[model samples]
Target: MNRELVLAPPLAPPRWYRLRRQLRDAVLALPRYAALLLFGAFTVFPFWWATAAALSSDGAGIWIFPAAFLPNDPGLRWFGRVFYEMPFWRYFGNSLLISTATTLLVLLLTIPCAYALSRMAFRGRNALFVLLLVTLMVPAEVAIVPNFITCAQLGLLDSYVAVVLPNVAGAFGVFLMRQAFQDTPAEVLDAARVDGAGEFGVMCRVAVPMARPMIATLAVFTFVAAWNDYLWPAVVLKERLKMPLAVGIFNDLTGPFAVSTNLVMAAIVLSVIPVVGAFALTQRFFLSGGGLVRR
Candidate 1:
């Protein structure tokens, strides 16, 4: 005779048990999700308000109490006034030129500088890096007076060079690019060298392609900064024609008469469109791992 043992049936979760688990998770995550949504709404509300103001009529008085979320009578009349009443197109073109030139020059200078700092073993490398880092801590306000004096001495006052030259050797761009270049795989660089590729060849064929994301990031940042710059351009450019859009807008808006809030809003909306477009076009690189060159 053999003794046999029978196994009990496996216990399955009750229907209410799954529902309870989901409820517990939802309760735990509710605060965090609510906070995130609140923050997003807070950040986005200003842009919505600005867009509404831009589309509103002159003497709309939307900025007053009991502000309307959407304009009652929306029109593009303010934008038309901005364009036709002022030299808006000329200022826009000047800003575009200065920003583009500054971005290009900064990229050209910073990329090689970052590559050298990141990849090469050389004397004073650590010291140089430390110095560069220190400069970032220094405020631009401290240097503005000296910069202006130098611009005057060089007779570069009122010139585009005065605005663009100061930004070409940006500390932040160099730092960002250095981090990007350092992330590149060493083996790939070594392979290029083993194949008799020179430093320049390796940089062109391997480093640049991998660093596309970082470069695009840098370009966007530099372009935005240069585009929105007002203080330096105002100090350097005495002539109305020589001034960038930022300073030009200030000059036009704050004349003897009261400034039209709607028109100013319209100008701001117009100014931001190009930067938004640029960011949208280049933003994919930030996620695509296009900047990181691997072996």
Candidate 2:
């Protein structure tokens, strides 16, 4: 059998075809670029407005026709005033203390509980976890009165301990840490056990180091949640000195003080810095730690 060979057409495109192809590529890319820029601007505009208003000389004054996003007079005086005029440092210290204590307690309680729940098997384990999930559905407000009575009975009102203890181990923290531990490899855990490691040792040595990223993520989240907590702290702590920054600002910055809207803006900015900075510093762990393997 014999077959005839056929000549192939030229593979290269003509110049106009190439230019039209390039134009099509550019057109397809335009919407993505436009969406990104629009999203970025929308996200950034609020921060800019808050910052500009915080620095404006007439922050509390009526708006002018030609609005300026950047203040004509930028000053640090409000920052100083925030500290000096309003028992700000005391509130700051209280917030710092309560938030730190809460985060630590959360880590201490969550790590072991989550690790055990994830790694160990016992009777009613599923039921217990389900119960915890049920508790999450119970709105925090429902517990406030009972918690208040308990705090009163324990003589913990007006104290940092009152604020810190009730919120120390949240359902979300447990769920998050549990998910993180589950992502860890079972083989790694088995090897640790084979190497003379007890259950506690295995968890501390193998599981925790592997989940550092998740832990850091949880720590930042817990700290911020506690730092921003207002209702519970307000109910427990009557004294202004004992109040966290949230309640302190709401209480002292109003009525007699009437918390200048600009000063309030400054306070809001100051409050946000720590949370943003914490996430920025630990975001690598948060992003990278979400894998399903040791490597």
Q: What is the TM-score of each candidate against the true structure?
A: 0.89, 0.85
Best by lDDT: 1
Writing each residue's lDDT as its tens digit, candidate 2 over 1-295 gives: 8999999987999899999999999999999899989999999877777677778767744244236577747887777777877887787889889989999999999999999889999998878888888898989899999999999999988888889889887778888889989989999999989988999999999999989878887898888888899899989888777888889888877855574777777777777777788778766664333542223
Clash tally, candidates in order? 1, 0
Q: State the RMSD for candidate 1.
A: 4.2
Supply the TM-score for candidate 1. Answer: 0.89
Local error of candidate 2 at residue 25 (angstroms): 5.6
Judging by TM-score against the true structure, name the best candidate. 1
- Residue range 129-199, candidate 1, lDDT tens digits: 98999999999878899999998899998899999988799789989999988989999999999999999
Q: CA RMSD for every model? A: 4.2, 4.5
- Give candidate 1 regions above 4 Å deviation: 1-19, 58-60, 287-295
Q: Any runs in candidate 2 off by more than 4 Å, and if so which?
A: 1-42, 60-68, 288-295
